[model samples]
Target: MPSDIHHPAAAFNRTSFEACVVPYLDAAYNLARWLARDDTDAQDVVQESMLRAFRYFHSFHGDDARVWLLAIVRNTFYSLRSKAAADAKHETFDDEAHTLIDEAPSPEARALISVDIQALQAALENLPHPLREVIVLRELEECSYKEIANITGQKIGTVMSRLARARERLKAELSSSSTEARRHDVR
Candidate 1:
């Protein structure tokens, strides 16, 4: 047996690790997929993150396993991102000017609007990384602001702020895409 096996406070048992951490494998991989923007790279990130998590499992305090694992995933992603090609540059999105009002379209207007999944996916891909992350965590993962903050190591207020900006940007991008498609159809 390992020398540290007898520590009662350490939640490092393999059984506990499987119970708490294994269930969230999809969530971890989904997050990595979005951040890495490539299936192969995302797989690599999740594998590395799971290894890191297991190696440090002794330190886990038995909090929300999803959040803890995601934080590890986030760190691993940035580490990988940093080591990627120098062509990757930090980008700032000016969302303030691009903000569009959120209004429900009438049935008639809705009928005229056409948005394909590919365009929506492209718009999501176009969002800046920070905004994309918050959107993915909150909207896709259904995480609360507090959970998102814990996962991202941001304050609750910052998470709220980012979510709002991300939504606004996404809406604007989708609306513009719809309009462009309409014009092309008319031609």
Candidate 2:
């Protein structure tokens, strides 16, 4: 019986790719979804990023695959947006990202939350992509200023400024929506 041993270099290449890059797929997809704002577009971005990542994987220097793949995701989104002549300054969210908060929580967070708070989540989801991404990464992902800057390819000051503006806009939107509901109730 002859046992066939694959070449050492190809085996090593396969091992490294599976270990370093394959595990980051979910994280890549999530970040891409946020950036692209559409599930279909997100998938496309992920595929493109994966191909690019694999092509350049040999140059990777660190173990933080999340950040590396996320950079690819960000780059892919910008490439498509620019090619389509999208407004560089404007941020848009696709409908798939829309969702109301879990109103009837199975946990204790809801103990302190009222209908207004639930409405606030829905309002925040309606915010523009740039604003929403900052909120999601900062608040939900609990990323630091430096990490946010790296992921979005912005200066640290820009990340702080954008977060402040996004929070202000979200507050106003939630307040107005809640106020309109109250007005309707009174009517």
Count clashes in each candidate, considering only residues at least 3 apart in sequence or on different chains. Answer: 0, 0
Clashing pairs in 1: none
Candidate 1: tens digits of C-alpha lDDT, residues 15-81: 6888989899999998887787777778899999998998788789988999999889988999988
What local distance difference test score does each model get?
0.80, 0.73
Off by over 4 Å in 1: 1-12, 88-115, 181-187
What is the C-alpha lDDT profile of model 2 across 58-162, one tens digit per residue? 788865767677777788877877787545433455433544446677444443344565466566657777777777778766678888888888898988988
CA displacement after TM-score superposition, residue 76 of candidate 1 (Å): 0.4
Q: What is the TM-score (0 to 1) of candidate 2? A: 0.70
Question: Cα lDDT for residue 60, model 2?
Answer: 83
Candidate 2 has which clashing residue pairs, if any? none
Candidate that would win on TM-score: 1
Q: Note each model's CA RMSD in angstroms.
A: 8.1, 6.2
Candidate 1: Cα lDDT at 57: 84
